[model samples]
Every structure is written in structure tokens, then in C-alpha cells.
Target: MKPGRPAAGSSHWLFTEDRLREEVTESQPALLPLDAWHRARGGRMVPFAGYEMPVQYEGIMAEHLWTRESAGLFDVSHMGQLVFSGDGADAELEKLLPGDVRALKAGRMRYSLLLNEAGGILDDLMITRLPEGHPFGEAGADDLYMVVNGAVKFDDIGTLREHVADRITINHMEDRALLALQGPKAVDALARLVPGVADLVFMRAGAFDWQGVPLWISRSGYTGEDGFEISLPGDAATVFTDALLEQPEVKPIGLGARDSLRLEAGLPLYGHDLDPEITPVTADLGFALSKRRREERGFAGADHILAERENGAVARRVGLIIDGRQPVREGADVLDGEGSMVGRVTSGGVAPSVGKPIAMAYVPVAMAAPGTAITVSQRGKVHHATVAAMPFVPHRYVRAGA
Candidate 1:
């Protein structure tokens, strides 16, 4: 919708010489197999996450709704996957993050954050221990797999390297392609192509061969569905994605739909919903802090985090379900009963699945409770809204033993 940006559904942008030059030369350090896939599929290539990627294929809205009803394959190869190895790896990582990395089972994963000394979030990440016989080898050798936001990959890598340089080995898996297959029908669709994929529960990961290519598969995603994120060699990513799209239930989704889907799920987008200015407590991500890690007080800004945990944060993130059909977009100001600004919308949109406008924002703790009345100001118009429970669409994660 922005000017100069390629219009939705037009693949003409993919043939621009600048795009080709960037993909072949400028983005060498972060290229993935999906790059070629996008070209072949008429993807409108653009610079994202330090790589040239498809912003949309068929269309954003159509791709978005299709993923909700069926399945959408997202090329998230731009995400940074770093391996940390050495003695006391878990303890070292815990010192930087407020999560109990040591408590994670070998095949399990945990959502966590990297924090600054002042309690600001540096980045949110998913940490998974390498499963037995995987490429990283057993845990004792001081190895851990970390996936971080692609937009901040360079900064994240630099910060990690600066702190743990002498103590561990950090391998950036930029050569790999990360594919997210998400939707209500994701599991069934993937099961037909990759046998045994459906058996894995949420947050569990394992190494498996897909069409003879070794891949790291995890039953996890950002779309609030029972899906999987697969990491494979970059060279084979296009081949693998093509195979997935051939399935009747799977299609390609773009960034616009990705944003809407996650918003419907009440999930936070790093730069928007979370940033260096926002603390994890105020962001409603306090659950990510483990009990042991909280008690140990070893991570950055532990003093502030613990204090907030005990006394409650002054501001808290909450969901807003608007009464009107018109969507309230990001940056909308939230007003209290007195028409005073209480907070600002971080992520907001018309949820296709819910058929209503929904938003997520951080309001003063006193006004964050469910059913609280609020107003959203968008382009000089006031929209009545109510604070609602998160995940406007209930999550379909397949928990262990579920």
C-alpha cells in the first residue's frame, strides 16, 4: 500500500536489476535457497533481513486467508541461527538471558529474550538443544541452537560475539533456509509430504531426512497454529519449498498476511510490539523468565526484572477488540474514559479469521484488566474498543501428550 512499493499481486518487481544485483552480490552473506524459489515463483523481491525475499506471491490478503484455512509456507531463512558451544554453555547463556536454558530437555525449545543491562529487550529468540545424532552433537560439548529475528541479525551476532567470544564457538547458520509451514491444516499437509512430521508436538524438534535431505524440523511457528519450522541447507531450500507447494493444501504467504496472522494470534512483532525501550514485564512476556533464572539473579537487568515481577509493572500489554468493522492500525493512540491517552497500539489490524478489528497495546496496569473500556484514535476518528483476552483466535498448539 505504500508508494513506490510494488503493488500487491504483481510479480514485475522481481525482475528489477537492483533486486538481482542485491541477491547475487549485496546479500551474499545471508543468501538462502528460498531466494531462487522466489525468482522462479514470480516473487516480487525486496530487501529484508539482509536478503532479497518475496514480499508477496499471489496477494497478501488472499495468501493470508488461505493460510488460516489451509496452509502457507513462509520462507524465514533470513532469521539468524547461531550455535554456541563450550563448557558451561548453558550457564553462560543464562547469564545473558533470563530463561532456564539448563532445564530445557534435549529435544525441547523455549522462548526467551536477550536483555540489556537496563532491562531493555535486545532480541527475542527460540533456543533448542540439539537432539541426539543431530548435526550439532550432544549437549555436554557446550552447544546450543538459537534462532533470532532476521532484521536484527547483524546486531544480535555482534552483541553475542562480544560477550562470549573467548568462552564459546558461535556458528552463524546463514547458509541454511528456515521454512515455516503454518495453518490449521499444516500438520496434515506436511504429514503427506514428510512422513513422521505429525508425531512431533509443539516446541519439540528432531533431525529427519526429507526426500533424502537432512533437515532440522521443529513443531513450532509464529502463526499460532500447530505447525513446523524446518531448517535445511540453503542449496536445497527451493526444491523443498516447491515440493511443499505442490500439495493441494499448501500455498505461499507474504509478509503482510504474516503480520495480520500473528496479530490475530496476539503475538508480538519484535520492532513494533517489543523493542529496546520496552521491558519484558510490561510486554506481557514475564512467563518467559524461568523460576531458577529469576532466583539466581545472574542475567542482565535481573534487579529490575525481579522488582517488576514482585511489584507488578506500571504498564501492561493487553488486547483490544474493536466494535467496528474498520481496522485500527499500528501507532493508534489508546484513550481512557476521560479521553486521555493511556497507551499506543503496537500492532492492530482487521483479523480475517475473527471478522473484526483487533489490536494489541500497552496500557497503564490499572486499565489493563479484561473488559476495560477504551478508545482508539485513528486519523482523527475515535473507535470504541474493549480490552479482551489475547489470541483472538485460540491457539492450536499440540502440547505434549495432547
Candidate 2:
């Protein structure tokens, strides 16, 4: 699958079987700050999220396995970096999102969603509380850092501005770039550049300076592996990326391997596995709503979302393991024993780390349990698949310590 397909709430790209190639042919893509850097490193460029990005550097399989074993540097600068600051920062944000914003302590990050009035997911995002001290002067004491998907960032900004602009100051960090260094050796490799980086636990964030450049580093990632996402000045992107590549364990990974890695990790790509039509409950992201928010029902779409939370979702997202090497792409219909349509594949691909064809789909709750047998209809061919436990590859997130 080529890049340039419409991505959902998260930052990863989706490759629809047939529409991608044709759509990108007619689309004009913008270049990233590290565009020339990627081209110089032999990256196969493709249009993605309205920007030209590397889909593969060496190759998807090699990059995916390399990350699982060693470390891989991903250029995810296209994601939106936003800062919200005000006197009532937490309270104001709580009105829009379902997460318990007030509970987020400084240096901690939480995964959350932007919802519509009807309880549909507007977008999924990561919110982190910056430390009390504002080192770079980008934000003040009462500020929060948010990372949203690039494709819908403008729309997300507009929506946020419309609602909270009058009260909170929204700062779009357009001059920043984001990078993810993931895998088993990720910490070992990153610690060499910034010694204190490894000290941060999973989902914790802090500010550090590399030479004179300031970086907002978070010990979290989407690949289900122990990793870090560093937000730095866009001008320093190439320099920092080059420095990381200098480490023997780190290699440049592209969108293709990123997609496959996330698939194996059971993470959903926004436009594919998540959309405006799907609520957090149906998307298997009920945890993002938080305990207090669930009970209070204070966020947008609280009525419908709370109802689904209490009762149940019409359909639930689940993992599928295909029997053969023929990779199942998105839009394939999932069928029951009698060939009745039970669900549809949202994100399907060859999982290099798992060494199998893995996919995610929304299916009837009755058939969503692991070990349930299902069939996938793809391109006039029927293939046997089974509902399996997600994160086909186990997650290796770093806890508080050790």
C-alpha cells in the first residue's frame, strides 16, 4: 500500500487497496523540513497526510524487524503540536474531552479523544502537562501540550478555537518537528545523546536541551515497544536525525514499516480503525474516557457515549489472524460461517514482526471474542481467519521504574 490515503485521528497513514494510488496521482503534497534529508537517505517518498513522506527507507520488512530487535528512528514531523494555556486550563479542556484533565500531573501524558456533540470521535490525541518551568518561553505555567493527527489538524484547531479560544491561548507549534525512536534498544541508543532521557517512565514527559536546542521528550510511542517521541525545533530535525542514525542500533524507518509495526502492536490508524461515526466504546478505547469522566458524563457527546459505555456498543473492534501469506487489506468483508457479513476489515496488512497477516475490524460483540472463527472476503476470494487477541506482539512499555 502506498501512502497518501486519508489517515484518521492518530498520526499513522492508511493504505486503502485501490483508491490510494489513484487519489495520490491527483493530489499535490507539501514537503516537510526534512524532505531533502529523507531523499538523500534513499527514502521512497510518497504523498501522505498532505505531505511528502518516506514510506520506506531500506525496506518495510527490514525496517520493521530492525526496530523489533534494535532501534528505528521514525520521522513523524507531520503531526500537529499544539499548546493550550490559561488560568483554568484543565477545567476548560475537560469540557471538550472525556478524560479527567485535572488529574493530569505535570510531566505526565494521557491519550484522549476529541468528540462531537453526537458522541462520535472527532479525533484521537495525546495530551501532556508541561513542567511548571517554561524553559523555551513557548508556554507558561498553566499550559498543556497536545499532539494531534496532521491530516485533521487544521480542522481540529478550528474546532478547538471555536470552543476554547476565548478562554485559553492555543499555540500551534508549526516550527517544531516530532521523532520517534522505538524498539528494545531504543533507550540504550537515546540515552547516549541525552543521558537523563532513560530516567523518564512511560507516558512521562519533560523538557531537556540537546546542546542549545530544547526538546520536549516523552517516554511513549505507538509501536507497543519501549520508545520515545521527541519534539524539537523543525530546523534541528535533520541534525538530530543524523545524530541518532550515527548510533549503530538506530536506523531510519518509514511509513510502511511504521504501519506494519503498529498493526502488529494492535494500534489503530485513525481514518481506518477510527472515524467520526465510531464512538470510543466501539473503537475499544473505552479506557481513554477515564473513570471520573465516565461517572460524571461531562464531556461532549456524553449522553450517547455514556449510554454505550453502560450498556454496550453495537459492534466492537477486534483482531484477526489470517491463515495464509496473502495479506488482507482494508475494505474486505468479514463473514460468519453461513457467509453472512459480520464485519469489515479496517486496517489489514502483512505484519513483519509477527510474520503473519494480521488485521483489525469491527464485528458484532457476540463474535468479537478471541478464538472465534471468521472468514474474510477479499477480491472475490474467501480466506479463513480467526478473531485473535490484539497486540499479536506484546507491548514492552516501560513502567514507573525498571
Candidate 3:
């Protein structure tokens, strides 16, 4: 870990701007399409996932609070967008993920995980089946649109290529830029530019045209708010982002606030909370494994995962509410009542929204229940905390008729 930065676990990285810039400046890191635009607006550039992206513009705390109350625009072009097509696309995807892909209706999105042979997560991704008769560029309507983490996209693509049959075509949409518009007023703000956007229910997606620019939008986000993820041509990114900021409800956000927002939502960062060694059951993400898929047991590592799901995993990921004001950083040792080391913090920090210290960690199943007592040892100081139900703040995902 870099000095003065939190050593968070998994693939989720917590990087300080100076350290990040220092490491990548020597490597000539690639710049995002909106690189210059961000620089012009006081965006502090940092190296993340091979892209020089914004860490913050105003500040993490303010950005986080603003996103919760209004809307925040985020540049997530660093993520990889993939379109998989073929007659057997759903079947092919099912072989890789334990999701009920075959039953996925057109224009619906599903949060799924790519599992290895051992049921350990390769990466957590969003999968959307394009509306029938709605083709994405060269890909057909039957194609499945997937968005994966930037850090592991290459590895994910390679693994998919190795496992999927030849008929399945994988087209990497590298020419696109992804943006997230999140918060309570997100729908109202976006609808001003793209009419009918407010109609997209949670977990739903559609292809729409905004000011002559084609957009593939999904009503989903990592912030656990009612929001949208827009995929547009790389060249149109700056213009679109600028347009969104024109609204009083929207402000440009950086990755620092993005991390805190997700953490407070009880969402796990891929690298920090999930890894090749962690399984869905262990991560408390068993919902990603569809029920029918569980019965069929055809996906990778089904044998072990099914057994673990039935009998219970040895250790499980859970939320912790620290008793004091001091925030605990990741890698801190978690001790049971007897003070024996039982686990370690994976992701933790001051939750601006929650107004207290909250963390996520793995502990033995017996100690994973809510209200369980635990102690964290960080920097030679011991702090008391209790197991709590996650999303320290309640998720505000807008559901239909709500």
C-alpha cells in the first residue's frame, strides 16, 4: 500500500492521487477521452486501471452527499463494455455465469458474477440482453451486452474466449465511454435531456438516441441509488457530461466519493471485497446465483458452491459498525471475544453518509450474525464494533410504483 493510503482488500483499490500519479507518470498511462475536459475543470488526475482519470473535483465528502441528495456524474470509461452475440449467446453465458440467462427478457439487466472452476469469482459484471430486434452496431439483437471492471477486463475476455465455443462472437466496445448519473433526482435531471428516461425501471435498459448521439442506457448503478449508466460514443462523452452538469441537480463526481458511496450502500468493491479466492456464498452474494441455475448445477464450481450454499460457508462477508469516531482501515485484524484473530477487514472507512465508521469483513459463519461482537486492531489500537446489517444506509433504488 502507498503511504497515507488505505490498504483495502480485493481488486478494489484505494489510491492516493500523488502516489497514483507518481507511479503512472513514469509509465505514460493512457488518458481518457475526456482527459483534457476534466483537467480544465479542476479534476485531479490519477492513474487507475491504466487510465488517467479524476479522483475528485470538489471533494469526496461533498460529492458523496450531493449524489445522495441530488445527482452526480461520474466518468467510468475505464470499464470495458463487451457485446456477445450468436444464437446461443444466453446458453454460452450460462456456462460461464450461474445466472438464469436463458430466461432473461429483452431490455432487462442482471447482476452476475463470472466464476472460475472453483466457484471463486473472476469478476462481478452487469449483463443486459439487448431488446429483440435492437442491434448494437454490428452485433445482432440477440447479443448480450456486458460491462466488466477495467482492471480485469482483459483476463475476463480471455477466459470467456477460452471457455465459450467458436460461434459466439465477442466484440469489445472499446470506442465507447460509460458514465453514471446517480442520486434521487437523477431521473428528473436525465429526463430533461432524454425524454422517457424516467420510465426505465430499476434493472431495465434500452437503446435511445439523445441529440443525435446513440446511447445504451441501463437504470443501474454502483452507488445503490436510483440512477442510470449511459454508454455513448467516446467522442460524445465530454459534450454529454457537460450537458448533464448544466442541470442544478447534477455535479461531477470522482472515484473517491464513488468508493464511499458504494461502501455505505453495502456494495462490495470487486478487488477489495471479492477476489479469485472468494466464492459467491462467502461474499454474501448468493443472490447472483439464480435459483434455477442452482438446481441445474451446470455452471463452473457448481458442485462446491451448491454444497456450501446448502451446508453454509466457513466464513461470510458482513458489515461492521465501529463504536468510535476513528475509522478503521483495511487489513486490520478482527478478533473474537477471546481476542484470537478470526478474520481481517477487507474494506472500511468513514462513511460520510452514515456519519460513522463502517467496514466490511469476513468472519466465521458462527460469528457472521448481526449483533455479533468483534474487535478490530489497527495501528496498535483496539476498537469495538458490532456485526450489522449492510447498506449501513438503506438503499434507495427506485422500484416501479414506489
Best by TM-score: 3
Scored by Cα lDDT, where does model 3 land? Answer: 0.86
Greater lDDT among 1 and 2 belongs to 2
Query: Across residues 1-402, which tens digit of lDDT does each residue of candidate 2 receive?
Result: 112122222222333323233234355887888999999999888777778888887777888899999999998988999988888887778878999888988998899999988888888999988877744365677799999998788889998988774879888988888999999999999999998998898999898888888898999998999999999998998898889999999999988788888988999887778888889999999889888988888788999998998899878999999898876667778787788877788887777767778889888899899999888887678988889998899999999956
Question: What are the per-residue Cα lDDT tens digits for candidate 3 across 52-108?
Answer: 899999888889999999999999998999999898889988888999988888898
Compared with the true structure, all predictions reach lDDT values of 0.79, 0.84, 0.86
- Candidate 3, residue 313: the lDDT equals 94
Best by lDDT: 3
TM-score of every prediction relative to native: 0.89, 0.93, 0.94
Clashes of 1: 2
Superposition TM-score, candidate 3 onto the true structure: 0.94
Q: Rank order by lDDT, top first?
A: 3, 2, 1
